[model samples]
Target chain A: MAARLARAPGISLQHSIRHAAILLVAGRYRDTDRSALCRLHDQLPQPRATAWWGAAPLTDVHDPVTIAEGDDPVPQLRRLDRDLLRGARASEPDWLPDEPPNAWRGKGDHGQGGKGMMGGVPYGRPMAMMGEEMRDGLMLDAMTVTIGPFLRTLPPGLSLELTLQGDVIQQARVATPAYSASGIASEPLLRAARILELLGLPDLARRARISAARGDDDEGLVAAARRRGALLALPADLADVRARLDAALRRGAAPDPGEECLVDRLAGMEWQSALLRVASFDPATLSRIAPAAEPEEGEEEKAA
Target chain B: MTAADLAFYVLSAVAVVSGWRVFRTDSMVRASFLLMLSFIAVAAIMLMLAAPYIGMATVFMMAVEMMVMALFMVMFMMNPAGLNPMSMVHQNRLSIGAAATAFVGLTVAVLFTDLPHEKVARQAPVIRDLGHELLGPSMLVFESAGVTLLAAMVASVVLSARSGRFGPSDEGSRPPGLEPGGEPAGRVPESEQEDE
Candidate 1:
């Protein structure tokens, strides 16, 4: 359904959450994912609306346009966006309070300086401290930043805190496991379409998306897809899995075994490659192999 | 002042302010971008001064250089977004003294220097002569600089390769980073009997 939203008329899918006007929460998200959902909502610049389609209402959103199962959300979503843009509907206010994430103000009466050269809170953020450089122990600053859950690069609802050096991901650990997309997870063609999209073979990805939408025999589409070197374009390991899935989808065969845990596969890979690897897992395998969506008791509130 | 004079004044002012911001701003990414803005302002002044070739090169080269610098900033700099105000500075006394000394030196140099008189028509010819010098006896200097940069590039690659760029001792790592490339999990392209 999310796939079809991109192809829908009068609607362009926003790859960056920053650009999106209407936040669409489709399917069942983890109940405790409210903070993340709120964080994503707050990320959209002012004059934004959220559509909670077949998902539980987040606490931060006082009012949301809700869509029932079997109903098309795109129309409702478009209506909300249009209304907000036209000023007919007031843009939803931010759920999180307007304040710095932490008390970044400097300590002491003067508040001009700190231990050594760093005074307390320079412009409400601290100066970066040098750390062991990733390459050759040439001391460099090591920055840790969180990516996705709402980030367009990752599978929807998968967030990770990444330690990085320039373009290299030094360490990657899941902050929030991806929202279990159970409905599409089992469908081999749908999964293949997703991988194709990540592979930058969008035309073939589109064909796969179309076939997945139609939900019928895709033999002709598969034939055209193969001719386009859809399978050949992928790196060998992924290509092998994708070809197997594509053939299976064409002939209506059962899904092959999952390639396995995406975390290790994702780790050490750079941002783009990590995304590709995350998208490679067949949905069924991903759901099974991925860490459970529900967080350990205390970990829930600690996420933000 | 003439329009060119005014442009030079405004652009030079902006360049200096932004150059100051490159240090004053805490955000590494912002500082990198600020430096690009400063370079661009100076480049614009160069254009106004009739150094079109050098001006344009500065603009494009600085833009690319800043982007690469930003990438590295994100790569290595902790808290690249400045989410947390990390204002830790070391050797404040020395840094301030050095900055003051350099400022005084530059001012003195500018005051003492004898610059060429206004010769707009001759600017093109001057550039042409500079082009000649590149191919003339001064070629060794240019060649040496290129060799130096090439060596630096090789050195960085080798150093990073040993430490894995991500960290030390990560060998046989799969799905190598965006910058570094080695054998990334070889996926054998199996011929699947052309599924009938």
Candidate 2:
């Protein structure tokens, strides 16, 4: 097949057909009569087939490696993560659109018939001329009026009409709906939402606030909510929390003290670091350190 | 067998055995893996016989093709990594046996046939000559193979991929809405919402 492919090959359909037949026959025969024949039928390129496996009768090659021990010696997989990150950073071109048309195919010299040999210019400088035309077409007499840069900063729910000067920001007009702000409260619920999100307890925080504002003040519900909130406020670093709890206990301070405005101190503290320090001395450790356990039978065996 | 003969025989035995197993293995994936081992052993034999490129390409191309098959297996199979027995055996056991017998008979006949021997001393290195041959007419085959691979990729993507540069609906699906940054919409519509 290689000899045939090497000799008379200019995309040989017959050769491919024969190759396909060989592949079809390469598989083992389960119901060797019917399915094999059907495979033989499909293997032929033409419906009224001629090409077979030729004279090369397929035989089973016994692979000893399958039964052999481990994997064949090869290099371990190379890390391409850093290289990919580097490629991503280096691909940022200034001429390209800020948010390109699509991430897969970003805008800039996609198709111009000619390749990159001419430094992004097509042969005969047609693209340069077209760019000039686009610039000229952007500047018209009707668009020459002054509309301030602040016009683009439309408030939420307000609409805007933009006028461009050759892909540059030229003028914009803002139009807001009448009485859109009438029903809304002065304190933006959204600010609380942002705060809660930053606090990393958006759902529970919002629910608690909403329930309290609605005046459904069941004392049990409020107490439970506050308790949960305080617990949630406790830093995720177990060691730190444990250390703080132990220190408070040691100093005879209240274990469940009201500690508002402590978010700044706790923020960004590493979880494992705090956990390790706190876990270093639990109740058992403290007892061990102080020799507080009463003497018991089989204590010597237990210690051993 | 003597150690030298044993080494030669064992190498030849494994090479031939694995080569045979390449045909016998039930799973295509396993078959391909076996074929790689067989080829590696054959390449060892080639090192003995003094031909390198043929052995290397045999290993290289087979490895590449097997890797591609592995990828396709991952993408298409429902249990992508599950090891299930896939028997490719078909119905022609007797005919297959007959055909195998005939081919083996022919090969044995070739082996038995007498031929005149050339008594020239081995001066030219076999690997060098093999490399030259590969770079000769075989180079065109090499390049065309590359082109064929590219064409296959383009054709496969054209046939199988649902979406292209234009839109998804071109292949009979709803056109996916474009997000400015390709992220999902931050706000969920009331209709799509479910109870937490």
Candidate 3:
């Protein structure tokens, strides 16, 4: 899916949803993530189109065109783009309401302002709540945000709620585990291509993707990829991912990743490093390493 | 009003609103952004006052600084997203008094004091002149400050390193296979776990 979208001529894939004109949802999604997907759809600026390929559509998106198996969605997507760009097709209307989630228009009585210190909810999005820092017991504003399922950096269907402290992840929870990457995209070359894409080595990434799509083992190509320093540039924690890709290339076999504790691995890691660690593992491995079972009563507070 | 005057007023208004929003907004993330907005407006004012380099520098530096601030707020702040209305204040009355006092002092100084200035003969190469002044008699001071900044940067990197702080075990120990010492750093060896 990524290979097709990436190789698509003149239809650049935007990393950020804010810049996106269309939401190309591929594969299946967790029913629980319906609200999140809707929020993502609404987040795109006005006149956005959503195309669901081999996936069910939630009612949040209006007039979504579902692409059947073996159908070329590129033409439909191009037409949608052309229409939207030329003002021939009216831009898709917003599915979500325009108003704030809560009633926040009331004025503050005293200078104390709103609910707490900052004037409460001048808009719909509520302010972050306080939490103690994990590194030190010192209290700080802990920003909790749910990222992905759709985020570029994350594996699709993998949703995480992170409590962060200044680029440091104080805590991380896998709100939704990642699904196994579908189709031949999970081939070692495609996987390597995806990793290269994440590493900002786009030329090598495109080569790997295109080479993989051709459906043959090219030892020289893998050697060329390695020569490009894409594998070598990875941090130490990502060595396992590199090894897995290496093993898959050598022996066309899937390595079973043993159960690893997600929080233990992610906690105390900076955001970039955490992202690298997450991306290092194949989707299957990542899914197997479920976020640690919710702590028991005594351990719950400490976990939080 | 002339375009220049109009631009100045519009920029000033933007700066003031952003400045006010910085303290008023509950969200730590939003506050950081508002602060950036204020800085950008101030930078534009600097540009209008004929300091293009300083203005652009201010814009670049403040943008980076505010991004870092937002990251910090996201990490360390109690409520960066501001889901709940938060009071990011303490000693409110004292803060109000201090702010008011500073405002009065600044206003009085600006209104009542006589400022002396003479047009410089060669203002075109002001940056070059400033550079020369720094490298000439002030070179020692400049070098000393640079060294100090370098040391601080080194110190911060060392302190913030994941492996260095508190204890080595604070971070996960290396796998037995990865390490050269033929021993695990902290976690139980897989061989030992298998036996147990």
- Which model is ahead, 1 or 2, in terms of TM-score? 1
**Which candidate number would show the highest lDDT if scored against the true structure?**
3
Model 3 has a DockQ score of 0.18
Cα error, residue B132 of model 3, in Å, equals 7.9
Candidate 3 lDDT by residue in tens digits, A59-119: 6555677876467667878887778788887777767778767666654544222555444
Q: Compared to the true structure, candidate 2 yields what TM-score? A: 0.29
What CAPRI grade goes to candidate 3?
A: incorrect
lDDT ranking from best to worst?
A: 3, 1, 2
lDDT of 1 by residue, B1-196 (tens): 8887888889989999999878777678899999999999999988877788899999999999999998888766655665444563569999999999999999999999998886777336757777889989899998999999999999888755654546444343344444666444432112322332
Worst 10 residues of 3 chain B by lDDT: B168-177
Question: Least accurate stretch of 10 residues (summed lDDT) in model 1 chain A?
Answer: A295-304
Per-candidate Cα lDDT values, in order, are 0.65, 0.36, 0.68
Candidate 3 regions exceeding 4 Å error are: A59-64, A107-113, A118-120, A136-138, A182-186, A218-220, A245-257, A291-304, B1-196
lDDT of candidate 2 over B148-168, digit per residue (tens): 999999998886664568753
The interface root mean square deviation of candidate 3 comes to 6.0
In model 2 chain B, which range of ten residues has the least summed lDDT?
A: B78-87
